[model samples]
Target: MNSSLTLRASAAALVLTAAMAPAVAAQPDDPAARSTIGVHARLLGEKIVPHKLSFQNTTVGGLSGVDRDPCSGEYVMISDDRSYLQPARFYTARIKVDAGGVHSVDFTGTHPFLQPDGSVYPPASAGDGKAVDPEELRVDPRTCRYWWAQEGDRPKSASEPVIQPSIQFADRSGAYRGQLRLPPQYEITMADRGIRRNKAVEAITFGAGSRVLTSAVEGPLIQDGPEPTVEHGALIRVTQQSRNGAVLGQFAYPLEKIFAESDPSSPWPPDTGVASILAFPGDPSRYLVLERTWVAGAGFKIRIYDATTRGATDVRRMDSLAGQRVVPMHKKLVADFADLGLSTVDNTEGMTWGPTLRNGERTLLLVSDDNFAEDEVTQIVALGIR
Candidate 1:
């Protein structure tokens, strides 16, 4: 199911809460997990401030892969449809956060984007080794062009894998201009171990100025589940070339660096680096990596990491995301429609940084991936990064 699809009005809130439940619970706890920095909170110390922003979920189309425009302050989200699987299209919306900290998101329209042949680039029922799924999206800080990564299964030995990474450019009106194919350098690999594992890529962002960064959802292979633990998500840097549009260097986040303080035998794995990565504007060297973990049964934990120092801190973790929680302007509820409706999926796949709320206050935005289940409803949440 496409997460962007619409539902009946009465069922909308139910679906949204249920879909968000697992993702909200994925933020598991770690007794050893420590934090030196402090930030204010809501929901009896369960919620943060920036989430007060509101979004108008559209009924006309399915949307995913949301990103914030650095220059315009507008939010741009894309709906991935490879022919029948998903049509290659983009959505443009303007988000307004009030002085009192009230928030709202409006979906303006859908921009139809296609491949070279004018047909959808990634066709549904795509075979192995084919370019079909578009997983992660990012905006270039310098040129403002949009970049998306293809996440599909690794081609079998008998099937050939077309390892091509590409970027898309658009005009101010959100019109498609051109695309440049990125040359593949490094394939996804395990942290302590070295081998290409899970082929799914969850999120992408800009890092260290003009550089690009991304995280794989799971290893090239799945553990017992379809995804990896927060500890298994790996971060890597991508270098682009001025000529021939080549991807130069690929550096995976060293697992030892992330788990340096954790007990070696402890079952609580380090962050799998799922969710999304955000490189702060103005300061590129500093970035925030989000990891959502489901440690025991249903509770969740969300952590923020300082990429420059390779340090991390827990932000908010709760037993239920849909239950009433105090934000800023009002009391709010987080509901995961999926848990109550269909497949049990909790995924926060989108993240971006926007203009500051106050004079010196920084803003961070996050959206959950509903995976388009009948009971799931997608949500766009915001935060003020201090």
Candidate 2:
């Protein structure tokens, strides 16, 4: 849920202190520069964005994406409302941060995205193909225009129109600007031909200088394979394209095996996927990738991986990844949330580089999407990079 920049917060008395140690690495010789979010990381502090917070008629939750405007210094967050909670909109807010930690988050504005015809997007209940499931927001480093990712709809019963996912732009006031042309592979075709339902694009980012845009599919496509299971992990595609939509490259990203088994009797399916991605500052070839998973009884598992595309095969032409021999992106253990002592991880989905510390270190900021549930909270977690 990040693009332009990232946020950081604090206050151990009021927020959870995320004192996570470095996650265990597979390669014994893996250097931290290639393994963790930074050489060393520690808990800064955290604060909550009041549950069910409302802004301009929009429920300020389901915060799937966030990015700060370099010119304005204001952070923009996209809600995955699907036009249900308030016409598929976003919110602007100021999150105070420093060496001590994040002090406060004050939401300032809210705006709804306009359709090409100057209308608000309709809800999926209307069965229209225009409903949007906004996932991430990034400020166009060049134009300052809002670039966002929309994870399209997967028709539940064939009665609803299949909405192909897309990357689109909008002005600061939420006026429709334009959209990027997506590769054919992203089209919603069948159970084994294209993007999967609800498991399509979840994260997107503009590389340094806004030269390239990178996106991560939440899971394997129907043709790629099954979801990550306790027995083994899965493969998902990470696509890079020019702002105007020319395919630059596509790489395979191996997801980790499900960390825990779900309740055998639970009806809900276990889940695992990339929740957010941030391009390494000044380098598109490297990234800080976030992975989150949930089992029926085993809560949530979240981690940050220092990932690199160097030496990885560009699989843009590969038809399917199942049984393929291509080398995927290389990723190393970063930070695992299990090491943090928190009662509830709360469906954390967004990440960004936060304000720089007095020590010249950058703070890592995180936001959680409560999914508008009474039991959940809208949390903003801050960590220090040292």
Top candidate (lDDT): 2
RMSD of 1: 14.7
Worst 10 residues of 1 by lDDT: 326-335
lDDT of 1 by residue, 188-251 (tens): 3323222133334555666556654433332322211122223222223222233235443332
TM-score of each: 0.57, 0.89
Off by over 4 Å in 2: 1-38
Q: Which 10 successive residues of model 2 have the least lDDT summed?
A: 1-10
> Which candidate ranks first by TM-score, i.e. highest?
2
lDDT of 1: 0.42
List per-prediction Cα lDDT, in the order shown: 0.42, 0.77
Candidate 2 residue lDDT tens string, 177-205: 99988877777897658888888888988
